[model samples]
Target: MSAWLRRLRPGRRTWLRLGRDAAILLVVYAAVSLWQTRHLASGSAPALAAHAIDGSPVSLDALHGRPVLVMFWGTWCPICRTELSTLQALSRDWAVVTVAMDSGDAAKIRAFMRERHLDFTVIADPQGAMSRRWGVVAVPAGFVIGPAGQIRFRLVGLTSSWGLRARLWLARGGF
Candidate 1:
């Protein structure tokens, strides 16, 4: 073997340590991430029927021809606040509705939305009943529902706007 190749090879001890650290990191990451998403429904969304904060009736069964973004958010959650922009941007091309989990009553949510300049549709989950029904345990959790009423993807963290748009596009068979 070439001297350079021999020099580049790590010693057995170094390799073992590196492998151990990597394995540990992987396990830790999996545990944390699973905690965030393990409770979310995987294939299809649940029967959702409620009134929007604006008093509009919201039923997922009625939105059959367009992809819907079901977002779970809390006013006090920093991650949810930060991810709101992505949701707003995606609202332009898709059906985006957020469930305000424990954010307060309709009046409070209206004021918060006005203050934040968030124009997307919102459903009030003042008691978190809707969120619990949706199987959402984490703030900022997102579920992409296809036009045919199937959940195409589930996002448990701060997902990018482009990632959401791409999922919507693919769900529409835009490929």
Candidate 2:
């Protein structure tokens, strides 16, 4: 031990170990995230022909010539709530449509959205049929589709606004 270090109680190694462990945990989390997204397709996204909460017909097939962000969420999901503001902001610039799964009827969803001040386009999927078709088993799932209707990036869990924006940029053919 160094002479100056010997003057104090000797537990400096424990602090080092804690930092090392935290770093390892972060690495493991990143590895798992990469593994989960490793094989997600860059090919065509699944068909999404449905009705919006406003009783208007909505179809992903019609959006083939533009990039779109498809989000799967529920009002009851906390993580979904966290991403809504980011999504709302993105909608003004990017084409974003969210499927509200298990969020009750149009009236209930409308009330919820009004309370939250969310103005993004929402398609209600109370029966979960459409969500299943998209292979979404969790809330707050997001897919960035390219101009050619190709699935470019998939996001699961609480994705940061910057991250989503970056992927949106990528979908727009930006580096």
Candidate 3:
């Protein structure tokens, strides 16, 4: 009888401890996940000014009542190139803006656009002011802004058509 009691006690204690730990961890994970999701969904669009390939001033004010897709990238990044192609193809129904991050020489940007026959507007952010304002520390970041100047979706790196579609859908007030 004594031996059986000891065996049962140890096993029960072990399982109880494990269950408590797992429950705590799960709660913490759920809270963090909720915070992240909410944080991403609740921001006004970063008010960064735009610039032309020649470094002249440009305004996003025209996009006030329309959806806007802002893509951050560098000419040297292959992922950026792919994203550019995808965006170019999808620009017919959406307003797309591609801002290159310090890829040097505006001519390079013009050349790349012309070579690809991309009709989307391409801007050069040589000073990185716009990049910093957008909280873009990495290349190939994307933001889909709603008509009210709110950022509905944000992509940190290279993304797919499905991702863009989902973002646009969200921007359009869809789930």
- Say which prediction, candidate 2 or candidate 3, comes out ahead on lDDT: 2
User: Model 1 over residues 1-175: C-alpha lDDT tens digits?
Assistant: 9999988998898899999999999999888877788888878789888899899998998888988888899998999899888888888879888899999999999999999898888998988888888788888898889988898877798888888888888877788
TM-score of 2: 0.80
Better of 2 and 3 by TM-score: 2
Task: Indicate the worst ten consecutive residues by lDDT in candidate 1.
Answer: 33-42
lDDT of 3: 0.76
Where's the lowest-lDDT run of ten residues in candidate 2? Answer: 34-43
**TM-score of every candidate relative to the true structure:** 0.80, 0.80, 0.70
Q: How displaced is residue 160 in candidate 1, in Å?
A: 0.8
**Cα lDDT of all candidates, in order?**
0.87, 0.85, 0.76
lDDT of 3 by residue, 7-104 (tens): 87667779999999999999997776455434232488766566777566656677788778888899888888878778887677778877888887
The RMSD (Cα, Å) of candidate 2 is: 4.4
Candidate 2, residue 163: how far the Cα is off, in Å = 0.8
The Cα error of candidate 2 at residue 81, in Å, is 1.1
